[model samples]
Target chain A: MTLAIEPITPLPELHRGRSLHNVWARFVNRVAVLLCWTSALVTIGALFLIFGYIVYKGVWALTGLEFTTHFPWFDFTHFHLNATFFTSLPRPGDAVGGMRNCIAGTLVLIAMASVIGIPVGMLCGIYLAEYSKDNLFSHSVRLVVDVLAGVPSIIVGVLAYSLVVRPMGNNSAWAGAVALGFIMCPIIARTTEEMLKLVPKALREASIGLGASKFQTLFRVVIPAAASGIITGVMLSVARVAGETAPLLFTVLGSDQPIFSMNSHFPFFHADLNNAFPSLTAQIYKYATSAEPEWLKEAWGGMLVLIMIVLIMNIMVRVVTAKKMAGRH
Target chain B: MSDLPVMPPAAPLRRRANSAWLRFVDFLTFGGAFGGTMTLIGLLALLIGTILIGAFPSIHQFGFSFFTTSMWNPVTARFGAWPYIYCTLVTSLVALVISLPVSLGSAIFLVKLAPKIRFPIPSALLGKSSPSGWTLLNPRIFVTVTSFLIELLAAIPSIAYGLWGVAVLVPIMQESIQPFLADSVILSDLPLCGWLPHWHVGLYLAHIPGIGILFADPAAGSNMFTSSVVLAIMVTPIMTAIIRDVLAVVPPELEQGALGLGATWWQAMKLVIGFSKMGIFGAVILGFARAMGETMAVTMIIGNSRPSSYSLFSQGQTIASLLANQFNNADTDSERQALYFTALILLMITMLINGIARVILLRVTAGGKHK
Candidate 1:
């Protein structure tokens, strides 16, 4: 090949007419950069606003044993005021721990929902990611999951009201737990499925080459490796459901009694599990409309408590996600 | 015995049984997932069932005019949805107009611009993801919150929103707009503000003609404008988060490649980010879907008027809100069926939205690896 030299253009002077266009271009890029930053800053500011206000309010209300304990008094003067449904505290103090009862109830319902929801979601996710080979079943699951996510909270409430709450009896957390699970399942499944897909096929092949069955490989290798991502997704699902109102409204029937302990009721605790209790979210709804000062304090306090809980969960997810992302790099 | 067994093949029945068992387990696994998926679809059915049971009878009595007629006189048992439908479409359309720019802009800002902006996550978190620790210091909190409040901002429950509109928004709107009217003569001509009742409450004391403003008449319900605000708040977080995520996925490499080729930054983003046609479309569809399914919050603020409105400030009803408010009152069988049909319509809408979103998301992901 014959050797050839390319001519180089001379640099233009900054003050000349030709430079004006360059200057304008540079200015535009700078402004674009500024616009990007401004948007991000504004978004951050909004988050801080939500966090600050909730914490500021939650601090005082989250005090005493009350922060942890206390169920409201559900006086169904017209309904059944059966002693069987009621549980009394040891001390019989002036005020029940407002949040303590709710905290327990919330945990139990959320935990139960999580248990039922997470596995199904993961499996559906697995099928979508692996077995799908991009199948019709998996594709339809995506559409269904999307619809589920968008369904209004009230409609979920109504369905739960019709199915679980009506047939199985009412004024209990089980109904609420099941309803929340119905909605949460779609979100957890869809996200988990997507996250699992992001794991390279090579990793799974490596596990299979070790003479592992698909089940063992999936459980021992793929799952544990994707553990952090799944955890973050689960946490987000929790945070999302934590704010839900209508579903619980129609399902739990809004009890005001101190709920059973979270740990004790696992597997089966008939009396407590069957018992009526309040959720922090449900309480916020009930108390928002009340005329009493004491109730008002509880409502605002509950909102603060809710904000804190959701924020903490969200932050943890973000941190875990960030760490997992960095580890990938 | 060992020599004979060593050369023998395993029994065909046993092997077949084992494979069958394995297949059974797989089927079980798949079924468990599909069952939950069905529940998601099942909810739409339940909602429709409830509404049709409640509203269908009225449809029979009122005929097809049940939808086309605007008059809703309870004493005469006359009913029509002309006004309600008008109000819903108008406000939602207007809301779409106002929010689409801000939300889409915010989405683009978050996706393309967030990296250059430090503390990007916090901004997204401030409203939803994180707590409000940093926001207490910003002066914009006052401005945004006040603006939101004037708009009855954030995810405050519906009851409070309704009360605020009744107690706060009405008087302000009435006083602001009434002064421009030509007393009775000019006011009489305005169809939009025709519903304002003479009664005054809280801050509104004037007997302004036409409910053109907030408290102009305070007829119908206080929710008129209040519901629209609530709807706006309810959908904003959803829009912001989804759009942000969609934008975030637009590869930086693509944008940089354009810029490296001597393209303007605008040109770079347009080519790179704008390529996310499916995602952007999905985000918008999902946003509209969010607005459609929203019930309690919208119910609280929207006037939930018997009839709806033509004007911006009048009470209007949404399909979801209507089902929520009226589903329980239907005692007749067909009355309930009509309500169910409304719910069916709502469900169909939701399904259609999801179906579209699924197609868009799939198409985008299919193209995700491309520059």
Candidate 2:
């Protein structure tokens, strides 16, 4: 249909038809160009609109002090004045609590995820890179990783909640960490394998020539060289885990109370078992869904806080890589 | 048995007992690596197994009936997943259709048309760069600003979409669009012909044919079109991002060769760019997958009123939303099991589709690598 308007074989004939089909030709060309641009623009532009709306609405709720601090402490009179911002200081079980507990829970959960996920993922990467030979089993494993990534995190949450929280009869942070760990491992292993593969065979030969054991060569020689890529994988996984909400919702059984203690005093914080704690993402999910306007504001504020933390982590990764590369000078 | 030759030994053996300790290190490296791999594979199996078990009882009782029944009466022990599955399929498919063209278009422009984006991070950091700029541009695509925006939008709960969809979209799509189409004699006779519900008391009469075509009388809330629109926005960024990554890998030579042959840019793209249909299709499937998986975003906009929908404007229920709305409300084991069966089915379907896509993508990539 589009090809009927073809140009002439020679320049003279092409010129003759120019005026008759000039506007039509230009219009066709314009639409063709616009079609491509519009499609791309729509893709990029919609993201902008969503962000614009979120930030525009959320700005009203954000305050520097509120961001740095947990839910503010206030009495009944203050609560009446700003009915949305609720903080019951004296052991009020369920009014509106600070995010202190959630913050601690998220950190502990993340720490556990790193511990459980990293070593195993790193080893898988090595095995895939050094052994397996992309055999049927290894190929199947690679396929499984993609499938795992596609599995909705909510399923992960449901699974984790059942395995860790429901059986234990408590909403502890440990279960949530395990869920996030499951999500993180496939991604980490793939990245690690790619990095490991980049290490030249000559380096291994050099080490072997010097009478170094294969294990020592891998650990002392290959690993140190590929440290940047491995770390990058960890950093990316961390960023991903931080953004998740569904997994935490079921596993963490988030709390409103401020939990300031970083170390043990909390039995649930131990590595031996699963425990529940609050995370910023989970809190946002709860608060945003609530009817109160004040709660909505806090959800927005919470978003800002979470984005900042993720941003900082990303910057840390970038800066470390940059500095390391520069130091080679 | 074929024995692969090791690199010819180049170094002198240390004449000490400790010299062979290095070989032990090699053994440990291989052992630890394999062990770690087994643990990860075990974790994946464990996760799936755990969920399947929990959902087992429900699966056993309902069998096939669980999918067809919509009673959801926990007090009497009746559970049906028809509504939830319908909504999930409808909403995700709709969103995929809406987002696919735009995402693919954007990806092509950014890759083939737009000038290469240059952000000079120090040169040494560029270890093992791919010839394709697709992966290179990932860092750029991920500038926190984009994700930051997505994160904020993501945090907005689904209920808001419900409130907004009913309040805003139902009226706009009905009031303005429907009446304009009526005077043109578009649909003189259609079942949707009706009066719309006004905010105050009256019904504004609308005469239109199509679901999107405005009618004199507005249809009730929970139309499929409105639900799909809201869902389209939610899935757009995800689809776009994934599409962009896939597109970044297309060889520039394909486009260049087309242009060199004197074909117009558009013609070149249609022929050469379209040939990599596999990757583009993978992207749309990714969008489809995300749409299917998304819970909160579509849940809000979809009018949760049951009795499955054929009209684009009527309310419908999706499987995930149905579970969410009813899980806490379930009083009977039968009811709960029906939900589990539905979820189990959803999980199975998703994994199967994803596995197929991965295989196709791997084959394409491996072929490209070999070429």
Best by TM-score: 2
Per-candidate alpha-carbon RMSD to the true structure: 11.4, 10.0
Error of 1 at A156 (Å): 1.5
Candidate 1 residue B29 C-alpha distance from true site, Å: 4.9
CA shift of B192, model 1, Å: 33
Summarize candidate 1's per-residue lDDT along B27-51 as a digit string, tens digits.
6656755565555456446655654
CAPRI-style quality class for the chain A–B interface of candidate 1: incorrect
iRMSD values, candidates in order: 5.8, 4.1
Highest DockQ: give the candidate number. Answer: 2
List runs of model 1 lying over 4 Å from the truth: A1-44, A59-100, A166-172, A258-277, B1-66, B69-91, B114-227, B244-278, B303-308, B322-339
Considering every candidate listed, which one attains the maximal lDDT? Answer: 2
